[model samples]
Target: MARIKALVFDVFGTLVDWRTSIARESEQALTPLGIAVDWLAFADAWRDQYQPAMEEVRAGRIPFCKLDCLHRRNLDVVLADLGLDQLNEATRQQLNLAWHRLDAWPDVSAGLHALRQHYRLAPCSNGNISLMVDLARRNDFPWDAILGAEVARDYKPKPTVYLSAADAFDLRPDEVMMVAAHSSDLAAAAEAGLRTAFIARPDEYGPGLGESAATVPVDVSAGSLIALAQALSTANTPP
Candidate 1:
């Protein structure tokens, strides 16, 4: 196998707990308005539209838009469905940015630090640059550079999105590992000639709703980012 030189990650479910964080923040933001829907369900409903919204751009039905814009549109639809559409613009904007404040998983900070010792790290997410930067600061993720959807003007599992990340580091596809909890994301990266690492995130969608394993084989599979880091460190150590 070619030596891996860098690591690019999937942000939402892979590194951050989007469901729990969004639900918590949404409840905090919406409680003032007396809108008492199931916040977790509300989060799921909003996320349910994620891929389809990206598909619109991917298929040329809409031009490229940041994930924040797509998230705002998705938020409005959910609010309308919940019959709580009376929220003012400021409130809606705050709620829309819930994605920006998502907390990293417990293992992420240390794991990324460890991996950063041996490889460059960045988020190759569908999230735009500003969103990724905000999340990185919020979570203290140490990334070498930001590269993903906005940079490519496209979303994953699009080939351009994956290839663009590799190009950003001036590295060949196989020299950078695409680390994600989602099998399809890794599959797309594999198709683009990048190496793959699957880190299981079984609670990404709220207990048991996330994937525990990759649907296909990957170059590495671990229970968390820390495990991946340890495995890689061990592999690189000389006898």
Candidate 2:
């Protein structure tokens, strides 16, 4: 096997607690406007629109746009669904930025710090560059660069997104490992000829609603980023 020279990550559920973070952010943003809804359900409802919106771009029904634009569009749909479409443009815009303020998982910072000692690191998230930058700054993520859907002009599961990230680092696909909580994502990366690692985020959707393990086989599987770092470190160590 080619030595892994870089590690790219899936940001939303893999590194950050998007469900709880979005719930908290939504309540904070909407409560002041007298909106009363189950915040977690609201978060889920908003997220449910994510894939379909991306599918529009992937299927060529729409031009490729940044995730921020897709997020804003999804936010409008969510607001309308909840009868909160009366919100002013400025308020909606501010609320749409909630994705940027998501909190990272507890193990992320230190684990990434450890991994950085051995390999180049960057986020291969579907999130736009600005969104990734905001999350990185807010969480102190040590990314070498922001390379993902925005950089590739395409979303994940598309071969270009993974290959583009590898190209950005000037590494062969086999020299890069795609770490994610979603098996589907890892499967896609493996199909694109990148190494794959899986870390389950059991509460990503809610209590026990997320994946407990990779449904597909992977090169490495661990419960947390710290453990993943340890596993990779050991595997790459000299005899």
Candidate 3:
């Protein structure tokens, strides 16, 4: 157990509330155009395309591209599926950026602030660098850097994504902790030799639609980023 020098995070559900945020942003953008739909279901429908889209990239069926491009592509699919294909290109582009305007989880600001006192922090998200920047600025996230899929030219659960993040900080895999809400992500990071932390986002999908606990073993498990920071602080405290 080497001393963890940096903390890398999976941004989507772990740090921010993507589902709710997307739903809100979607309603705000689309309502102006008289598009009436169940906005929450719209958010779910759009998110449903996420994994399959990444699988296309991960499987080499598509050339590597930014998550923004993928989001735009997925947005097209969702729009067509929902009979909202009448939207013009400019409006579509605006809606596509809903991902950029997500609100962070309530505990995020205080937690990141606490953790930043002792460690380097960055997002190891599948989101492109610009997307990460937008979310960071929108939420006042104090990222020391942004390193993720676009930087690694691949998506997560892939070893390179985790290892590349470790390399970005010039730290050994064991010296970096990968914090995420998903157990599968932690399992992948563990396989890649990085320490893992699970911050449960039980409502990530909607009310009670997220995991309350990690299904896989992790170095740390907590209810929120603030709790995680406290757990790490306690662990580092000398007896």
Candidate 4:
């Protein structure tokens, strides 16, 4: 086992619940206009846009884009495809910015605070730097540092994103662990020479989150970052 000096976390669905936060705001943004849409459904659709959008960028069909722009483009497409047309340009932009106001999971702040006492904890997320900073301030996340894919000019699963942080800290790959609710994120971290820890965010994708993203059936699942900190603490002890 390796000594984990720092823990890197995924923001969306891990440190913050993008689905619920965005959907709640989406409802408020659209209800006054009588759009009659399921904001939750729209939120899910917005999240679903991530993979294909990244694929476009990865394939060179699109130029390099930040997660914020990717999210904004998807928001517009979802609104139009769902027949929602009442929003003015400014309002649409406001609605698109729901990404900036994500709510942290119940234990997130407390957990991160507790962990910060022991390790150099920071976010290693695909969100743009400005968006992550705003979210930290909005949600009061006590992260010691904020690492964004935009800083690397690439996204996770690209390898460069993970390595850039390692390069920044002047640490070897094994010294960092990526904590995430999504297994795909953990898998990427593992591939990047970082350790992997899965923190359960059961409601991340809303109430019916499936086994595909759930942790109950996974191998290295942790219920919270507090638990993750405890586990790492134990691992670091001298025998």
Q: Judge candidate 1 against the unseen true structure and give its global Cα lDDT, from 0 to 1.
A: 0.93
TM agreement with the true structure for every prediction: 0.98, 0.98, 0.98, 0.92
In model 4, what lDDT does residue 109 have?
A: 89
Cα lDDT tens digits for candidate 4, 55-99 = 787677888888889988887888788776656888888987899
Cα deviation of 72, candidate 4, in Å: 1.2
* Candidate 1 pairs with clashing backbones: none
What's the TM for model 4?
A: 0.92
C-alpha lDDT of residue 164 in model 1: 97
- Model 3, range 1-239, lDDT digits (tens) per residue? 23999999999999999999999999999898898899899999999999999999999999999999999999999999888889999999999999999999999988999999999999999999999999999888999999999989999988999999999999999999999999999999999999999998999998899989999999999998899988999999888
- TM-score between candidate 2 and the true structure: 0.98
State how far residue 235 of model 2 sits from its true place (Å): 1.0
Q: In model 1, where is the ten-residue run with the lowest total lDDT? A: 230-239
Model 4 residue 148 CA deviation (Å) reads 2.7
Candidate numbers, best lDDT first, in rank order: 2, 3, 1, 4
Which 10 consecutive positions of candidate 4 have the poorest summed lDDT? 210-219
Off by over 4 Å in 4: 208-220
Question: Candidate 3: lDDT over CA atoms?
Answer: 0.94
- When 1 and 3 are scored with lDDT, the better candidate is 3
